[model samples]
Structures are given as structure tokens and as C-alpha cells.
Target: MELLFIERISTEQLEDLHRISVHTFRSNYGHLNTPENLQQHINQHLSKERLKTELEHPEMRFFFAWVDGKVVGYSKLNTGQGQTEDYGEDQLEIERIYVLEEYQGNGYGGALIQHAEQQAKTLGKSNIWLGVWEKNPRAIAFYEHIGFRKIGTHTFQVGQDPQTDWVMRLSL
Candidate 1:
């Protein structure tokens, strides 16, 4: 419980982010997606090259949580603009947030969410939001515990299946 040290991802940590993202995806979604599909999804969206490119983007923010110099998790943030946007005047969307399974029961997810809120606040955002898979009851409960309330629903593709997600929001 080292307070899950969190910070904005730096250029030097792109590879680490990619590595942790793959691990997170595998452990968290292996049951929901086939190996080949998971690999394809993660490789396309969470690869090192994609992280590097996004980190260099002007409108997105990425944060990482580390312990003993090893990244355990990360959350991606973005400014609201188009289609899938948050509801704040300066909305900061939690594009993604993850914690390794082994670290999940130790409050790391809470730390990450709090860190993301602070980061959003730092950017002048008054609210933060994210989408959680509808069937992920544990995740939905955790988000509610952290003060996020479901405001809407959206559909996502999970492998060859369609999935439901609840749009959750929190005031910063």
C-alpha cells in the first residue's frame, strides 16, 4: 500500500506503459475475449507505438502508477470534444484505467481514480468520466464507491460479441 505513487506518463516510460497494458488486458479480459482477439485489440490500441504517439498528442493525457520503479497500472485521460464526451465544462474523460489482478484488492484502483481526479482538476476540469462494462459488477461497484454514477449506456464490441457499458461520471 505504498499509496500507489502516480504521475503523468513521461517519454521515458512509454514501453513500460505498453508492457503493463498488455498484462492488464490479458489478465482482466482473457475470459471475455479469445486470445487472438485480445492480442489484436491490445496490439492495435495499447501498443508502445500508440502510447508514444498519444503521449505526444496535444489533447490527451496519460498517467501511470508505479511501485519500486515498476509500473503496476495506468489510466488514460482526454479532453472532451466529440461523439463520446463527458459532461463537464472542461470534461476529462478516463479513457482507460487498469490495475494488475494481484494488486487489485489493495486499494490501488482507488488510488488511481483519485490520482486521475487530481490530474483532471489540475487541468481545470470540473468533472471526470468513464465507461464500465455493464457486466463488470465489481468494477461498477468500485466506481460507485469512488462517487461515479451511471448516467448512460453505450455498446462496445467484445471480440465477436456486442457488449454493454454504463457511462459513469464524477464531479471533480
Candidate 2:
């Protein structure tokens, strides 16, 4: 494993962003969902146009994890009005954090979460939160290992399928 570096994504990297987002998302969730649902979710949330709009949002931030000059993962953070839920002004929401299948267990996911925490602190946030799918025990364990606690639950729609997500939070 080469040194992992995280870069704040710029609008010029829209194509790279879109590529990684779709690939990682499908790789992670495709087998667990119907083909129609998976494709619909990708089209609705990971499309180039949607990614570009998110990249341009003032309260939203995107970061890419790079190793040996290749992007291996990415994370998306939201503050204020950009947050999916109203966790309040002092909190930052990690809307997405994903590492490619081949790159898992190499600490890239933890690095991405650390990056999010630093960003949240920089923005004067006291807490950082995210929604993790209830079925993903690996993710739930990972977040728990990092000191995040399940504070609530919410419905996360992947296409037309409604799924339960554990709302986890960590106080800075």
C-alpha cells in the first residue's frame, strides 16, 4: 500500500468524481439489490449532472483518496442546508464515504473518516454524523470502533426501495 493522500475535489474533476462514485457504489450494493433498483439509484444519485451540482454547492464538500496516483475512494460532507437531515447548525453530515472493493481493509476508509472529522472541526462543528445502512454490519462495526454511536434511525431510499439506516454520531 502506497501513501494515501486525500484531495479536495474540484469542478474540473467532475468526470473522475462521477466515475468513482458510480463504480464504488455499484460494487458495494449491486448484489444486494435488484438490477432495476441499483441502476435507478445510480442514475438518480450518481449521475454526472447530479455530481457536478453537488460539487458546486457551497455547503457541500467532496474529497478523493488517492494512492500511487490512482483514486481509490471518496467521501462527501455536507453542512447547514446541504445536510440530508436537520442535525442542527453545529453538526456536519457525512453523506457518502466509500472505498473501492479492492482497496478495502487497507485503512483508506478510516482515513476518509478522519479527513471528514478534520473538515468538520475546521468548520467549527461540534459533532459529525452519518447514516449507514442497517444491513451493513461491517460498516456499523467500523463506525463503532471509531467512537460513533447510533443515535437514531431513518429511511434511506435507494431508488424505490426503502431501507433502514442507523443514524450514527460522534461528538468532537
Candidate 3:
């Protein structure tokens, strides 16, 4: 079945989006991080109020993919917002791109990335960037396969442990 795509989530969809985020995040990262940390991440990132606030942001936008009447994946992009000031006028960043485990490895991720890149181009951004956890080699490889180059790194705390992440980018 073809997935129906939603480019702008409506207010009514906020709760469903939050539910999807929590479910997808837990299933995808639960084994990769401590349960405590994973729980913390979900609490901070997937709350309905937080997501609604994000959607209300003037510079924030997201794309969602649904199949069989259920959302399976989503990707969000936000304008520089200080995160890409180093790269300046030509750059914007992907805030998040997630596909449920069952929907992964099926080209859904690539489609979303391509859509994000096009969105950046439409915004007149010359470059698009995203951050990836160091532990996710598969994700790194996938990004590279799609033309993202690793340019830098940053340290972040996932739950209670400090970890490094790679900054990857592609020219739009």
C-alpha cells in the first residue's frame, strides 16, 4: 500500500504525532541506550505540549508518512535558529528524522531525506545538515550513501552518559 503523506500537521494531529514519537523512539532506541535515559529523552522530546509548540514555531516544519491509516515515519526541519549560524545564510538543519523499526529499510527514510533536501532547496538554503549518534553506524552509512559528509562532532548526554555525535551535511 502506498503511504499517504502529510506535509503540515493539523492541531488535531498533535496527539497522534506525540503518540507516534514516543512509540517510535522507544522501540528504536530502547536497546541502544539505558532505559532510564531513553525514558528521559522521550519525556523531553515527545510530549504533546512540546510538539505543539514546535509546530507553532514560524520556522519549524515537518513531513509525516502514513500507511494503512497509521503514521509510520516523520521528519522535521527547522531554519538555522542559531544551530547553523556557523554555516550561515546557506544552511538549515534537519531537527529529526525517524521511521518506525518496522517501516525502516524500506526506502521510507530515503524518501523523507530527499523530501527534506528539496525543502531546504525551496527555502533557498544552499546546504542541509543533520546530527547522528556515534553508536549508529547503520544510520551513518545510510546518510553517506545519500551524499551526506561528516564534517564535525559534538558531545551530548543521552540520559546520564556523555556521548559523541557526528555532524553530517549535504549541499542542496
TM-score per candidate: 0.88, 0.98, 0.90
The digit string of per-residue lDDT tens for model 2 on 1-172 reads 5799999999999999999999988888999999999999999999999999999999999999999998999999999999999999999999999999899999999999999999999999999999999999999999999999999999999888999999999999
Decide which is better by lDDT, 1 or 2.
2
- In TM-score terms, candidate 1 sits at 0.88
lDDT of 1 by residue, 57-81 (tens): 8777778888877677888888855
Off by over 4 Å in 3: 1-6, 82-86
Clashes of each: 0, 0, 0
Error of 1 at 72 (Å): 1.9
lDDT assessment of candidate 3: 0.80
Clashes of 3: 0
Tell me the lDDT of candidate 1.
Answer: 0.80
Q: What is the C-alpha RMSD of each candidate to the true structure, in Å?
A: 2.1, 0.8, 2.0
- Candidate 2 whole-model C-alpha lDDT, 0 to 1: 0.95
Question: Which residue pairs does candidate 1 place in steric collision?
Answer: none
